[model samples]
Target: MHEIQDPLFKPFALGGLELPNRIVMPPMTRSRASQPGDVPNELMAEYYAQRASAGLIISEGTWISPLGKGYAWTPGIHSPAQVAGWRKVTGAVHAAGGRIFAQLWHVGRLSHTRLLDGRSPVSSSAIQATGVNVYVAERDGTPGFVQASTPRALATDEIPRVVDEFRQAARNAMAAGFDGVELHAANGYLVNQFIDSNANDRTDAYGGSLENRLRFLGEVANALVEGTGDKGRVGIRLAPLTTLNGCSDDHPEITYIAAARLLGEIGVAYVHIAEADWEDAPHMPVEFKQQLRAAFPGALIYAGKYTAERARAALEAGWADLIAFGRPFVANPDLPERLRIGAPLNAHDRATLFGGAAHGLTDYPTLAGSAA
Candidate 1:
């Protein structure tokens, strides 16, 4: 009998880069940037470099500007120091022979005044992200999660300036020696605040209709595509059914399908769909997956709670071109190698998931380093 192939190890061609495997390290916020400037540091570089076995590594969500930030200690791409800091990260990953992309992010409404330099958070509407909290420093200067403050609605004229922020952030990513940039349009952040129905009640050119809601996404996608000098170098992450950050839609199916088709029309390189991961989260309909596949011409990446069997099944079924593992990569920096050999994986420390030293960040021993 012939040796069976492992689907997870299959090579994928992403734009000009040839990915060595199908395992992707999706963006996850660790809030570990250096203080005083929210800059990426050598510790962050070591964390990413340790996981270089991944086919493609998408860095943590990086704020595009100070006004776009919603969390304390998260890195930004707009400042010269920030760019130089990210250079260390990209150089480390590349030195380890890994391809990485910077995730450009803007948390529109999911912010506190403390995180915004006393400025109210801005969003598509003046709505509070009830029941949600963001990382902020207390009066004593200790960092903690606080109830998100209500956001002010962005004026129609202010939208373009926000788009330009993302455009410039992409240029900064290139300057930082990154291979590409991924727009964090997913979750309940800034872009989602605009795309979701309840979060947006504006009647301007950017709201009140499906086409209007998509205008911001389209403009930003175009800006990243044009700014980066390659349509294939740009990717988008979208969350259609997630309500984690107080964002909801009356009709997610219709809205997202139209969004996917618009992205296809714009000739983007990939679209990453973040499947809801809550304990009782509803299953994503097979029909919607097929529709997304038909609508977007490039690669499709899906991230959620996934096992190797389920991931292989999804790839065999043909909707997802790449599968991203979040926590798995956290505890198992050599995750791809471990999976290939069917080795046991390490458990991640929940307490150290964010804002910590290297103890939980980069101390996970690899298969060879651990005892049997």
Candidate 2:
């Protein structure tokens, strides 16, 4: 085994899993899953296995249920076919000796009527999310964004099913040969709906008080742990100060602090935090980020606008245990080696990011590989 000499290449443990370095390939939605329902495909296997040089790979957000899907062509972990599809992916990655995890997600109110089951996306309240769903199409073969529709509050009885969805997804992930699973409780998804006061205005056990609001997330995490059987293998992603897709909560400091502490108590493998949605995030102050670092008390993974240099700084500063590179990894399959040798990075093609063939997906070149 080659020992990493760069401070950024240092080995660390997220629970029982030992990473080769501190680099992480965060989840990026490619929308390439097979049509109708999101199912992993051979292309996905080739894409992920090609990038296995990273310390850890967190797969794109996979819907825990059909209703959890908010966009077109995203993958799901709910069905046997999906499981079989992912098995090909995991098998390829494992054959290359790469560690990977699946991120379980629910879009909550982000879904449009056109995207939902019977045109209903259940959330914590009836509030319409802020900002435009950027993926919406317009007339005349153009594209435009529009305000989100009002979401229905999930009934108290239906909440358990939501938790169960995550549990079952974790089970399916393991069965499909993933090393573990990560809960997509961040980024204004279903779990975030319950955490954000503006989104979750319920008068029931799942809302109001902080404890009540975090109840579903707690259940989901615990259930995933029980299902996956390796606490150190499971991870959770949280955007504590995200404003994208109109996600903002009152008392973010308190809510996130409490959440980090609670997640620590539950013994998850890692906590993936998107420091801020944007590069220069005005929402998350340094003090709040510091507080989260202190409260989380687990393997900390930070993603968003990070370079290898910044990743090294984060590790040296002890603010992040792992650094997840999003766009860089998208265009560079051998990202870790590129950073190791200070090579020029290929810029990602925005046009081909969402739905495309291997033209922009798996065709990115590595230093030693063909540039075809």
Candidate 3:
């Protein structure tokens, strides 16, 4: 039998970025960016910099355009202020000897009119997203769900402009000194909407066949690669099995594998796959993941309720190149230290997961500091 090494402690090269370990901090929206339009702030910078010990930190989903926003307080990369704010974040992370990547996003129908710059939201189809957006709030300090604003399907003529937004966002990320950028093509967002049959009912070239359905995504990926100039500096993330927050598709396995094959052909740096987030929702089935692994020939990062032991298993099994920790890294800023020393893991507080200040965000202590 071949001896399998622990991927958790292994050094891997993601394009030009060298990660000391295979532990990645997957992008999680904190909803803490400045409101009106989620501009990156000092607090956000501190929050990410504090957790810089992870091998690679992928910043939270940031809108590439104002029309792409769907959540309150989530950051954007479309404006000068937002770009400046991100420069501060990258500077801090780089100062701390950490590598960071920005995840460019567009919420699509997952938004309400309140979140859009104007009262208009856009999608591949004129459908409303099925679930509630937790970011939109009521008058008092309580969480409420609003009906998703009706979305206007993207006209074939307008598709090129949408593709351009991704290209510009990638350029902006590099300008801000990020190591690279990840296209948020998963989680039923704008790109995902175009891939899902139920959400995309267009009759044009970008709609009917599988090739057409995947055209927008392919263009977006091609644009990012072209924008980056170096293939090793770009990655993409997909949630092919997420059935949460009102997201679903006809055949995720076939849809996503074909998508991965295309990315592999383009020679992307990496592909982050979120198997399943919601506890009750079905995860990326083992068979499906095997198929995706077979289809994609890049550094593969897996996220979703993963334990260090499981991460090791995945690496040993050759199923994943990296394991991304979400809530674990949130509570244990010294996650790499804890893993290295076999220290106890910190319990994450669910109450303060979103829409809050420093308590659960920045107050988590490192092992060395906590013991002292």
Candidate 4:
């Protein structure tokens, strides 16, 4: 590959912000937030600062409310201290000359009472995500994964409160010094629960038809934009084909195509599509890609098992404006530089992917050190 002419290195404008490259570090749940309050800390700052070379960094999924939290040690953006903690992280990233966006998240049916202070998890419908487990603290404070319990469906009046929570979280993200925010409307979370018909069994206006199903997502997107005071600073992520966390739509193409069109009408900054990456994963047809490109007026970002070659191909094809590297950014803090020079990458250690200290988080060496 000709490194000089690589599209990944080219600059692109995402709304009002000018990105130096097309590479994005999409959100990955590291589960490394500080104890007691689940706040951001200096260690997390160092981790993000180390990978500042990426054109953009979307933070790990953060809960918008106490009820939104689903995993152990994942951070929250609902409190003053949490906001203060994230301020340090944003400062570190900005000082290193990088831009960051907080990924606002709320896990609905994917939670256990252990994580919800004895309150049952809520979704658009009362459904249990079978065969799915969420990370939690054990009896002795050890980290473990437990099967999620059946969730309660939100009442019609309660829908507005959910929207308000997201609105408040967006304001909190701005107060925490983030450049922008991304809605985690994927992977069977609260927003995804509303979007996916299988997870949402409501007969009310928030469910039933595709249009009704998209109501919650539309409300949340508008809330985020209004709270942030900038439509260009807000982005929403959707997974059209992912079965992870038991999220599926009867007709993915119809559901997501309509979703893209709705988001385009909303005039948000961008739409991030999370592709399935596991072995034997279903393929996303070129036809769907074309339809999605036509539906969404804003920039499009694709993530999930993307390699340099595939990323380049996608950019050359003219559909994707940015490509996100999830696990690669976890191990290679200087991933952009490594890709630019075609240097070998450090393999990520799966054991320490979550709930660990700096050993697997920030201890990975750069190319120069590895060569030396």
Candidate 5:
């Protein structure tokens, strides 16, 4: 197939935005925000601007508040400084003719007191995600990783306030010049904690049955819509089958199919599904994909370790409207162009993947430079 004829290069309408291609740069936490306040810095701005060739750029998981933070150096949207810091990033992307979205996130049970100012993390249930470690700042001001502490379940009345945090964060994202907002409701974060049955063991209205488990996500989705005043500019991400952060459900298809239907009914712009990408990961059944398409009317984005051929096949089969490239985008700033021309891609350095300087962040050579 001709490179131009590849489905990945085709244009598509994503809500109010008309993307030039179906290639998306999904959010990946690099943990490089400025110290003392977890502020987005010029380095981060430059990093994103370098990859502005993507059809849509979703910024790293940004904490909505101090309570939402799960790792050291991850940016936040709750403070004025953080907002100003991200503004530069959004401005940079827009100047390069790209659209960006802020991914609002809260780590829930996947957090430690060291990251939460000595307070226990909050979740739907008082459960500790065993065997999970989060990045943190050591006592000597060095970067380190620590096991997640046990979490305290949110009080029944506290749910509303938690929802409000998402609302406020959405407003902040818009103020920071984001084209839209994507709720980070996957990967065993706070919203994922509520959705997964294994993590949410409460008997309250926010737990037990699947419907109750969905209430938190629904409320948060609604809050983001209300805050943005435009449902078309809001989106949600879900990982129904992922056990990345100790999140699991008895019936992932049932849980996520219903969730997709709810998001479709709410009129969000898109639904991003983060597929399991690890070696030996279980395949997402074809039946589930068809059911999800029927349930959601908006754009559907699938991301994992998708090769160019696999992405084209998914688009050709009408299973996904867009394809997101995560790690590949990390090393190839001009990923769409690289994929278009079948150029060699730089392998990402695992050691410098997180909490790094410019060595692996913005220093990757582009096709033009490499040819020279």
Candidate 6:
């Protein structure tokens, strides 16, 4: 037998789970979850099972409660039906010898009333989020992007309920057979609304100074840890500099490093950094990366438009413990094997990226003779 000397192929331990390689398939929303209920289905199960070769797989953002949703056709874990749906997905992945984690999410102010059962959306503050469109369906079932509705600030008394929602989501994820859970604290969602300076402007415990702003995240992280029953089963995603959906911190370095330290103190398994991947976006500063490493005591995974070379370089430089690929995995279900052997990847159909069936979802072919 021949051994691969490449660092990407090397196995590493992420908390209590031992990963077979350094390639991670981070969460990417395909919006194909069964509609009328927002439940995971056979199609989603097959889609995930096909890509189980990654060192770890994180499921697409899953809403924790009815109000946590932000888009159409995305799945939720708040209901028994939704949990049953996710069971098939997790079973399929484990059958293929893969480990998967659920990405618990809430959109916060980045939501429209149509998706909220004609009710106003809630967030850290009563601010209207703009600059990015939320995906929704009209009365006629025609789906398109629309400006989000102005949201009401979560009442001081109501904040704990939302945190409990996250806790419940983690418990549901474990019941659904997920190996672990990742809090979708990144992006301009509920947790990020509380974390980002510009998005949150409250005089309450969840806003004002950095420590106050970080209060919500700490509470949610602690809840998730307690709900999961093991600190090693929890992970967090954070975007320090990315301003997508208007979620930029006043001082990204200070904000995210402190977040890393907080998660470290909470003893979550890992912290996944989501870099700005838009065209011509500025690279994350090395000094900031170094500080994040110093602050956090768990595995560090970075994702954003990473190529094979860039992934390897990050691994060798001690910058990232694991490297995650998003778009490439869509075109190549056997992405890990393809990367291991330097095979050409198939191009993904952008037209079929969102709200599609098997065309771009599970129809991607694998290596000719291999079943992966």
C-alpha lDDT of all candidate models, in order: 0.92, 0.85, 0.85, 0.93, 0.92, 0.92
Q: Which ten residues in a row have the lowest lDDT in candidate 4?
A: 1-10
| Candidate 1 segments whose C-alpha is farther than 4 A from its true place | 1-4, 139-142
List, residue by residue over 161-265, the lDDT tens digit for candidate 3: 989999999999999889999999888899988887777888898887778888898899999988777788889998887865566778878888998998999
Better of 3 and 6 by lDDT: 6
Q: Distance (Å) between predicted and true CA of 306, model 1?
A: 0.9
For candidate 2, write residues 1-372 as lDDT tens digits: 876568878888777778888899999999888754578999999999999999999999999887887877789999999999999999999898899999999998988776664577789888888664735434442334455667888999988888888888999999999999999988888889888887788999988999998998899899999889888878999988887677778888899889999999999978998867565775556577688789877888889888888788878887778999999999999999899989999899999888767889999888887543
TM-scores vs. true structure, each candidate: 0.97, 0.94, 0.95, 0.98, 0.98, 0.97
Tens digit of per-residue lDDT, candidate 4, span 1-372: 545589999998998889999999999988889889999999999999999999999999999999999999999999898999999999999999999999999998889999999999999899899999998988786788899988999999999999999999999999999999999999889999999989888999999999999999999999999989999999999999998899899999999999999999999999999999999998998789889999999999999899999999999998899999999999999999988988888999999988879999989998877879
Between candidates 2 and 6, name the one with more favorable TM-score.
6
Candidate 4 clashes between residue pairs 3 or more apart in a chain or in different chains: none
On lDDT, the leading prediction is: 4
**Against the true structure, what is every candidate's RMSD?**
1.6, 2.3, 2.4, 1.7, 1.7, 1.7
Point out where model 6 deviates above 4 Å.
1-4, 369-372
Across residues 1-372, which tens digit of lDDT does each residue of candidate 1 receive?
554488888889998889988999999988889988999999999999999999999999999998889888899998999999999999999999999999999999898888887899999999999999887865675578889998999999999999989999999999999999999998899999889998999999999999999999999999998779899899999998888799989999999999999999998889999999989996889899999999899999999988888889888899999999999999999999888888888999998887867889989998878865
Candidate 1 TM-score to native: 0.97
Spell out the clash pairs found in candidate 3: none
| Runs in model 2 lying further than 4 Å from the true structure | 1-4, 134-147, 277-280, 370-372
Clashing pairs in 6: none
Lowest-lDDT window of 10 residues in candidate 1? Answer: 135-144
Give the Å error, residue 18, model 5. 1.2
lDDT of 5 by residue, 197-308 (tens): 9989989899999999999999999999998889988999999788988999999999999999999989999999999999998889878998999999999999999999
